[model samples]
Target chain A: MFNDFINQFWPSTVDGLAFGSIYALIALGYTMVYGVLRLINFAHSEVFMIGTFGAMFVPFVLGINSALTGLALVGVIVLMILAGMLASAGTAVALERIAYRPLRRRGASRLAALISAIGASIFLQELFALIVIPNVFDRPQQGRIQMALPQIMERTDLFSIAGHPVKLHQVVVVVAAVGMMIVLDRLVNGTKIGRGIRATAQNPEAAVLMGVNIDSVVRMTFLIGGGMAGVAGALYLIAYENTNYYIGFLFGIKAFTAAVLGGIGNLRGALVGGVTLGLVENYGAIFFGSDWKHVISFTILVLVLMFRPTGILGESLQQARA
Target chain B: MALALGLAACGNGGSETTPADGGSNAAAPGTVKIGFMGDLTGANAGIVIPPRNGAKLAIDQYNKTNPAVKIELVEYDSQADPSKAVALAQQAIKTDKIVGLVGPAFSGESAQVGPVLEEAKLPSISASATNVKLAENGWKYWHRVLPNDGVQGPGIADFIAGGAAAKNVFVIDDKSEYGKPLADAVRAQLATKGVKVTNDSLDPAESDFSSVANKVAAAKPDAIFFGGYYAAGGNLLKQLRDKNVDAKFLSGDGSLDKGLIEGAGADNAEGALIGCPCYIATPDVTDAKVKGFADAYKAAYNADPAIYASEGFDAATVFIEAVKAGKTTPEDINQFISTVDIAGVSKQVKFAPNGEVEAKDIYIYQVKGGAITLLGKAAEAKLG
Candidate 1:
């Protein structure tokens, strides 16, 4: 088992980091929503899923079939990222207005909000599977089958790290994800809107007392969080080269686990948790075979929660602001 | 709440109208209703659609030739779900009063729906459900045109271990109802043939196979046999090639399609082999009946018949012949099918005591220049 781990160390680590970046981006959404509303926001997965379709739509609209190189390729990538972010942010806002807002106005319990989110998730999934994809997209034949994403860039090795070839796509995914995380971190810590978000999350009653406009802050949080998930969705499609209606469910669950592992409400903790979970699962597959990968991931989650309920980074919203 | 109520009302309306429509169709004289069940819009759609089309073509030809007995085909898309297949079977039996059924298409769905059809005494023929255990179920009404995995698995193992001359073989499966049993049978055959075999299983839902690819690289097997559908199979093949493992890749009928080439990329998929029980309608096929069906299929569907198209055509032809002999009731059709022997497009159609095809044969195909080329029968290939 150790021998297997030793042989596969570098390649597995590279793969783990590439996938870990995606988890971190999605984990931010779960963490942010939980920080403010203390609601699980199960529908956030659908937000990420819609972003994938949005990204695909951009390429379809551009009439791009073959690979585009150089500046043109860069332009398409940027356009897809923007489209994905806009679509997902729009979806998140609409979900809040339609589902959560009505329930919130009636002073509904957190459990009610959670159930509503679950219903929204299921509704969005079936909507895509049954109606939108078949009727609107005119792809009645590709129902439930994962549609292949056009390969915009060739998967050429950039350089060798310890005899393991690192591909260009992997580098792009990690750099883009880390850059987005940094920008988000600065936004939450630096801007006035960021301060309002932090205030609302800390204490909604006190934030309303301080004229923070808690509702706007909450909506903004959702928008920002959803935008990150959108970016993750685009990156995921580029890396895996496929998209489907059901992609969000597994990814969302994994990202949710990452958020909890890093301390559910902490921003930095989500990043830490995501990367660590990715690396652990990959290494565990090496030691225990690939079939046990999910088992090892969930076992680590159970063990972490049992030992240190607060998680590795610990839930510290105020400390994060400092 | 209004939306929910409206949806409920729509559902009620649909159920009410279905039986009424079915009742009228059943009451129509000189009309023989044939039920076809398959995955039209799910994971197995790639494999199921061609067979479904073939069945449709056969029924169209039969109706044109024998105008007195108008055969009406009622298709139900089970979407590869067993529960949906069972429901479709019930609807065919209780509502449509179908004289025969063409398929439950997938193995898992067939296994679940088989007993139901058996209980109803409805004669059914499947084009692609090739699980060996399906035949062992002792369902008097259920029959399959394609040879089971028991015949194909050993043939595949023989090709890999002898024809390709790979001493060390690695067997992988998606752990599906179809894939696992086929992989197990192939592994057993390979071991019996004095070949070293390593067994591995993958979840079909997983998109990445880099971990498994690395494991394969470490094992250093000379040949890899995958028992799964095209999606996972193609991804695994690509990942394995990326790691520079120059092993001969082999798979079953599940991975036999243009989809595999598209998924694995043309370069990586070159020279891979797929063993299928279905007949490859090569230009060399001299059977006049097979030629006629192929010509009709090409004209009808605007493409060459795929792997199971001939089998599907043959299955429908068998049922049509039985219906023409004045077998109107379910039991009459079942009784006619049990002892009937007819020459089909693929082979001589005759069922053994266990509801399996009497004469089993496997065809080996190679991916050459981005197309599947028939490399003759598996038995003709020299075995070590």
Candidate 2:
């Protein structure tokens, strides 16, 4: 009985991790931004969408063919990734400048800041609807040669170990996300700017008094978070093989939930929360059937918040450094 | 923006009194306009856009051959949204001056637009709408060039029961109007074959499905039939395999897309079976006209033409034939269409009293290395 259950259960757990990777990637953006600015980047999903749109656009507009050498292919992909990152990061910065900057200047409360994030999200979604593929005659041919980076990020095969099939993409997503979190942890604990950002997040007044340029720190936070969302968007397109104007709504909400579940305003908490949430949702669906997957995930979220508002990792922003 | 496009097509008709279908016979003073409603942009556009392009090719060719018959094609993007579909139907009938309409490719949109077209007394022929109740509504002007899910689901179930000799089948639906009805149809037919049926429902929006996979694997069915589009079907197929479910994966037309193979991973989708309601790929007929049409469609769309394109061409051909048969007026056209029979790209086109096509051929296919290979074919003798 145990062997049979292990045979069935282990593979599902692995698949769950694969999906968790994508959630973790997007959650990183939510956590990092919240870690520094204490504001949820509601427009982060749009950033992901733009990244996918950009990924598809490169090979199409540039007229790249499938016969290119490996080096040439890498060059084109690197260029596409850079362009997508720049576009997403620029939009994130601009959104902060236009939507959140004014509110911040007015000394908006957390509630007002949250509202501004909501407003920005709506605006960007509408912009996509009217100006992007939804209204356009044809979707921008989203790059030449679909599934361009198959070797690095393909969906996992069915049951590799013990002849059990598994999705490759789900596993890659989880590992990449966890790997990214570890790198982020190292950067935060090891780097000088990490100390400054930590100080700013802990107490902005003290950081300002200590001569930290809070504006630059905030800008860097948006850039890194926005960059992560862009990467997530690109990865999502590879995983799903289709991109649409409204692809960001569910993912954004889930990532936010993950951030909250891990304890909002804590970076490591976000990573842990995202993977755990993804695993829980996957396991819940497997047991109850997929119809109840979201209900199960959200119910866990509500119960967790009610039981321990500080989240699984109870360390607040101030306590993290202390 | 959609309204302007409609008026622009009609305003180009040159005269308000002459019918667009008049062809060169009377130099047709008005546009013989056929309106289309579909998701020009959005998730389903990949399917809808190619058919529209094929229709355009047919229209261009039809106009060239029959100079007297100048049919105007106007389109509105419903975006696969039901409310938008309703609004578009109203505009197509009231403002576009369309005598006939084709499309709103999805089953859900067609359900919403059915009554509106019926009230307008405008005959609408769809190339891809497949719900069974769509034709059962007693809408006088409604017709479908493509087969309904009733024919498709049972046809596939017959293939599974007869060909695979399967006794236990698990049916799953994404819980949408399209998925649920199709699954029910397959389930009903499978039960008739003395096959045991286990049913499951899924939410299309959710990305994960480990728990469901565990349960499905535990059920230990011989096969699984998914009644949803590729989006969720791909993930479900992958996770089912992860849970070590060795059952043969089966689904209707919704699961048939290149994206499914890629998204589900070729490894997971291997040995999977799918069926589409139309089989235009058969070489049973060697008509030069069909080959020419196929070549033109491939050249224009950069994708292999499917039964939907053939159905779209047939819809256009039927309209032209109606015009030539002294159906210049809307009433005459309606009368003419009810009795007309013409060789379409799919088969000889003839509609029953309720506007359902009388004959259909469903094609069963299997995915091997991310390629759809024809497995078998099933045909219907008649529709009730």
Candidate 3:
């Protein structure tokens, strides 16, 4: 096992980081929402899911027959990411308004909100499975089967580390993930809206006393988080090259685990936690066997929760979360 | 409250619709119901749907003869889950009162459904469940239509060593009951054949194979055997080719669907070999009985017959034979099913005392020019 790990360490690390990048991006959504409202935002996963479908719909509908190159390729990638963001961020805000706001106004229990989020997640997945894919996408034959996108971006190998040749998509996934996280960090710590967000997260009642509109801050929180998840979703479609209704659930679970591992409400915690989990899973797959991948990562989660209880970074969306 | 209620009601996967051919033909002296059970909608539904349609076609053809008792082929969609299979098996035994059963198509469901069918003394002939231990259950009423993993594994192992002439082979399973057991069989056989084999597992539902693909690249085997369904196998194969592993890829009947090619794009899937006890009817199949069944199936469902369709057809024939012998109740039909010897589309339909089908050829198929083309039996096919 050690020999196998030693031989393939670089390849495994690179692969793990790329995977971690996806988990990290999605984890931001879960973490940001939890930081403000103390809500786990189970529906955030569905928001990410919708983004993936939104990303490629235009290209699929208009029939992108020609191969894109240079500026055209960059433009297409931007358009895909923007489309995904619009769909996901819109869904997140709408979800807050339609599903969650009503419950909040009613002064419903936190359990009620959690249940609603869980319910909405299933509803979104099944809606795509039973109705949307068949009727809207015009694929009536096998609604549950994956809709694989045509390979638009050419994925040539740029270089090799050890024996593992790094492909274009893998590089895009890691670089885009890191770049997005930095932008997010700057956004949350730099602007007036960022100050308002930190103030509300630190003390909701005091922030309200300081003349911050709690409702607007919450909405902004979801919009930013959902947008980040949307970018992740688009990146996911680029990396995996396919989308299915059931894709979100597994990714959601891992991202949530990442959130918890990093300290549920802390933004930076989600990044480190996600990358750590991804690395652990990859190394575990190599050392123990691919069969024990989940067991090893999940056991690590249990150990973290048992000992630290708060998480690796400890909980705080205000200061240390960045 | 409404959200919780909605969640509670969403466990079942697909809406159950009785075939139009089944319902209106019960004008004979007696009406007997036989259940066709498997996943009609789910991830693996592509492989199951053809067999369901084929079974319906057989029952419809029998109903055309205007016999004393009309046969109703009721469908029990288990969605390929074992717990669901157990519940559906009970529903078939209790509410539907099906005299005979044609399936619990996957291996996991068959394991769960076995004791229930045995307890009820309801005779069942599965068209596609090929776990070898299913036969070890001592279930008197259970019968199979194809060769189990015990035969398929060694046959594939022999082909890898003798036909393809590979010394180093990498074996991967999806880690389901169906995949793991078959993979273990292949690994055990490869050992006897003096081949160096490395083992690993992946879950198809997870939809990421980059980590596993990387490991495969590092290990660098000459040939790769994946014991799983087409979706994961194809995706994994695609990633392997992307990483330029270029190992000779082979999988069992589980990965034999056209969906695999769709998953791994045709260029990458080219030359990927598959071993199966189930025979699909392509245009090149000159056998009259197979050709006729394919045409009849196309006319019935407007679709081509795929893997296990004929096995489903043959399983339904045994139940039809039970009806022909004036066996209407479950006990009489269960007893009658064991005695029937009939020539069916795939082969002569007969069961040994252990309820295993007669040993048949495990055909080797190669993905060529984006089409799954037959390459005769495992013994004859050159893996080269």
Q: Per-model C-alpha lDDT, please?
A: 0.83, 0.71, 0.84
Q: DockQ values for all predictions? A: 0.50, 0.29, 0.56
Give per-residue lDDT, candidate 3, residue B236. Answer: 91
Better of 1 and 2 by DockQ: 1
Of 1 and 2, which scores higher on lDDT? 1
| Local accuracy of candidate 3 as per-residue lDDT tens digits, B1-384 | 322221222223222334433223242348788888887767788888878877878888998898878887777767787887787777667665778899989999999999999999999999999999999988999999898999998888888887888899999999888889888888999999899999889977777787788778878999999999887888899888888899999999998888888788778899999999888887667889889998998887777788898889988988888888888887888787777778888878778878888857798999999888888788888854
lDDT-based ranking: 3, 1, 2
DockQ, Cα level, model 3 = 0.56
Model 3 regions lying over 4 Å from their true place:
A64-68, A320-322, B1-29
lDDT of 1 by residue, A1-322 (tens): 6877787899889888989889999999999988888888999999999988888778877777676789998898888888889988998988998889899989999999999999999999988877777665677656566676656777788998777778888888999999999999999989998898888888899889999987898899889999999999888777776677887988898899999999998999999999988888888878877777788889999999899998888965654656
Clashing pairs in 1: none
lDDT of 3 by residue, A187-272 (tens): 98888888889999999999999999999999999999999889988998877777888888888999999999989989899999
User: Which residue runs of candidate 2 sit more than 4 Å off their true CA positions?
Assistant: A1-8, A35-38, A51-91, A106-172, A189-191, A230-245, B1-28, B66-69, B206-222, B234-247, B259-272, B281-289, B295-304, B328-331, B366-376, B379-384
List model 2 lDDT by residue over B1-384, tens digit each. 545533433333333332343112222364477666666555555556656766766776666675665776666667677877887777766655667777868889988888887788888788788888898898888888877898899988888787777899989998887889899998999999899997768877655555567667766899899998776787788767755688989888877766577657777788888888765543333687677777877776576775367777787777777876657666677787789787777778899989988877888878877677667675322111
* Model 3, residue pairs in steric clash: none
> Which candidate has the highest DockQ of all?
3
The model with the greater TM-score, 2 or 3, is 3
